[model samples]
Target: MRFEPRRHTSDDERILPLINVVFLLLIFFMLAGTLSAMDPFEITPPRSASSGEDNPRDIVVLVGADGRLALDGTPVAEADFEAALAAQLTESEGARVRLKADGHADATHVVALMERLRAAGVTRVLLLTIRDEA
Candidate 1:
């Protein structure tokens, strides 16, 4: 009697190529995709006294929730804010500022403030934010 040809059947043989294709797609996406940084939504940073230790001329600019502004804890009027910051910059060796904006503060206002700070010859501006504790 003649023997029929043996047929090889295995589920793994069918799936092996699919697994390789999936892994290749995964690597392709990982390499092609760009990573971006996002701002934290909820995090409180611990209080530290060393924030200004590096620079004696470092000043903190506060932006309140109600559009109020303060330079070094002294409240400043909106119209005079630029002049006040300019004056601080003139007195300091390097124009560096720490911006402490309230969570509820307007985004436009903060950006405007940053622009003003840059226009006023501020070399650097640090945005102080609390660390996420979750």
Candidate 2:
């Protein structure tokens, strides 16, 4: 009696790699989607006895405790901030700016930023904050 070796069928050979690649792609997209761009730094807004409507479409300017700044969630360099901010608001003449300032961040810096926003032609600038108990 002679021993014979069996060869893999074409169906099995082709399908295995296809299934593996599909799974890999699925996992890749799942992770990529979950790992979207996050804010460069975290901030704790001050509390206030105030309430107002917030438009989700309104632009946000996040100010960190370390004097770091981000425009619409993207970090912006102080040197080019005027140009960058102007570029962002070029279309909207009366763009509403929402300032999210960290509780511990410099008040002077926050004011300065607000001034810059005003200079950039933002007519209405709202300082975002948590509401305190009345």
Candidate 3:
């Protein structure tokens, strides 16, 4: 009977390359997303509860602290805001709306805008508020 030595396969040798490749892809995507261009406008949503899952909204209406309105990131004049919103609502019946108001935005203005949107056939509106860390 002849006795032979068995080959030993090191698990780390196969896993090290996989880990290196994963890290390289992660770094690449992080850089790519950081450099990606989006709306030039700056908006910071108000924070409150941070636990619940958020519902999807079809249209976005942003209210800047200075009383400016942006429909889906495009600026809409005060006089034209309702018209634009109505048009969007009509396009999608019973449309779900999301209002992203700046943390410093006036409460009255936000309420007024909500009333106007309700009048414009937007029955379902979600006012987005950021979750508080505390």
Best by TM-score: 2
Off by over 4 Å in 2: 1-37
lDDT of 1 by residue, 66-114 (tens): 7788887678999999888877777776657988787778889889999
In order, what lDDT does every prediction score?
A: 0.76, 0.86, 0.82
- Model 3 stretches with alpha carbons more than 4 Å out: 1-37, 50-57
Q: Please, what are the lDDT tens digits per residue for candidate 2 over residues 44-134?
A: 9999998899776677889999999898899998988888788878755556888999999999999998888887788888998999986
Winner by TM-score between candidate 2 and candidate 1? 2
lDDT of 3 by residue, 44-117 (tens): 88888754444444788889888888897788889998888878777766558988899899999999999998
Clashing pairs in 2: none
Off by over 4 Å in 1: 1-56
TM-score of 1: 0.57
Report lDDT (Cα) of residue 21, candidate 2: 96
Q: Each model's TM-score, in the order given?
A: 0.57, 0.70, 0.66
| Residue 10 lDDT, candidate 1, scale 0-100 | 100
lDDT for position 45 in model 1: 30
Q: What is the lDDT for 131 in model 1? A: 52
lDDT of model 1, residue 116? 88
User: TM-score of the candidate numbered 2?
Assistant: 0.70
